[model samples]
Target: MTAPFRPLPFLSEARAEQAAGPRLRALRQAAQRAREAFTSEGAATALATCDLVSFPYPTVFAFSGAARSPAPYVMVRHRMQVVRFQQEGTERVLLFNPSDYERGHEAPFFKALREKYGTFVTTQVMTRRHGTVQAHLEALGLTPEDVDYLAFDHLKAQDIRRWLGGDGQPAYFPRARLLVQRAEWDAVRCPHPLERVWYVPEGTGGVPPERVELLSGDTWLGQGVALLSTPGHSPGNMSLAVATADEVFVMSENGVATESYTPLQSAIPGVRTFAEQMGWEVVLNGNTRENSLEQYSSMIVEKVFAGRARADGGFVNVHPSSLLTRAVMAPGLAPTITLPPPMSGAFTPVAAPRHAA
Candidate 1:
């Protein structure tokens, strides 16, 4: 008789407790000051007031205490910023989160965050305004009419479809060759729809030869840089590790957030299920959707602790939660990129075997 197939166990309660140890307490303390400033001055003024802002969420605090099991965590989907940096006269401009397809109607939400946080948060405004088609043209130093045929074209139709729902034709963008881990790619294509849904591309074609490079094994990308395959949130989701001149920054893509601590008072069951499938650990911060300063502070503290511990010896920085504030604040500390040495022995792919559809 064949043994029954078993799923990986969720985070154990014991693990969760350990995860929220003393390190978490320190982070919470730091977050308290930030949260107080945000509430007292409002998000915008508080952000403008900071000497150096790292992750610019409108507010950061804790809401829930502990959970019985390691179920998927839920985070409040608030307005966020997309960050990118260039090496100055190099072909490589490290693009953080690219321009999202949803806009126009979504501008109010974005505007609200900006209003609360301040205008320091910069987005690929041109892309957000004109759509990815035009944005990629600008990236390649070309105009829409300049190229005879669009190359390296890979668009995420499903994400577009969801956000655009009943809107006009979904936007498309130039396909850059991604440097994703093998396990991450498999998780992205998992049959469990929500597990890898957000970033699962409908198609990947029109790729340019010059722009595509695949990293097959455990290897660093740039000098003293590594890419981690963090699969809980999205399948192809990965974080960047940069050991810089000053500190080590791990750019976790879809990890936990301050809002994830809130209780599920009125979350859509379907959306909650989706969040779970994507591997989030949600807790209730309050009985309502509205968050309080204390709760925000607690959550931020937890996130910081977890983020730092995950970085181990490296210093860490996260993408700002509030876009408006981030745009204005100077990049805070030098980024940290930590890469644990590869395990000794022949490398084996960590992906589960793909089943026939």
Candidate 2:
């Protein structure tokens, strides 16, 4: 069996918010301040808004929570982002964690989850736009072949075959090279017991070997674009560190939202409780409970890198609730919080993984 699910340590705070008291008032004040950061008029700047994000969707996992909802449990979201820039004067288009490959095959992703979690989950990806990679590229006025490179923080719920092709299907982005960490690739072949249900069927089975550029540890796909292994959410879990015009942005699922890392200070009740008790760094992602200790470490690493790398506090979590959509044009979807500038320097580079079976 997979490791036991660790319940959030802030249940009391959630309960506290229900009662009328000084603590409740304080918590409500904090929560309100946090919500204000997501409004368009807030202009809360830490990390610059993303250049382009794939269809923003809510994918409720077996026990995931909806964005900003009172639900303190349940992992959700799972969105993607694509970046475009020039390296040494060469135009480059990089897709970060490209998902929603084929709308035709959404059921299998959830079906696999049901098999492993022993419960039916609503795997639907709620998107106002088309939920396909092509749609993302189209929004940017580009095509799959135009993509210079592709990378994923980790490949737990991802289906590379969706883009690389499988089961006799043709590759989605024929010209792009997949920059996957060697450790992440290994897990794709032999997933941990807890991860069996998160991936797509035959996800990487049909990829052409030449299309993959596997790295043993941290690596640079291009100037100012790097793949760093953070490894907590999944053994091979990693983060993308990109130095952009606005500032440096760290994209990882570690915290899953701006709410995870902030003001060494925050207003959200659960966040405030965890921050006060566990220390602000104790905040972590909504998924993966097997290695709470390690995940905590990973989130710390993420906080340091993200906090320092950007100013606006936009860690660019793949699963940030709609309430904290850093750059969206919608209400309650704009970024609200900007952590004080990162205090520390860059984190130690990722080393090759030492797996435990």
Highest TM-score, which number?
2
Model 2 stretches with alpha carbons more than 4 Å out: 1-77, 85-89, 101-109, 112-131, 308-357
Residues 303-348, candidate 2: write the lDDT tens digits.
4433342343334222331123333322232333533321112222
Task: Judge candidate 2 at residue 242 and give its lDDT.
Answer: 52
Badly placed stretches (over 4 Å) of model 1 are 1-91, 103-175, 194-212, 216-218, 256-316, 320-357
Model 1 lDDT tens row, 22-47: 43454445433422332232111000
Residue 40 accuracy (lDDT) in model 2: 17
Model 1, residue 249: distance off in Å is: 2.1
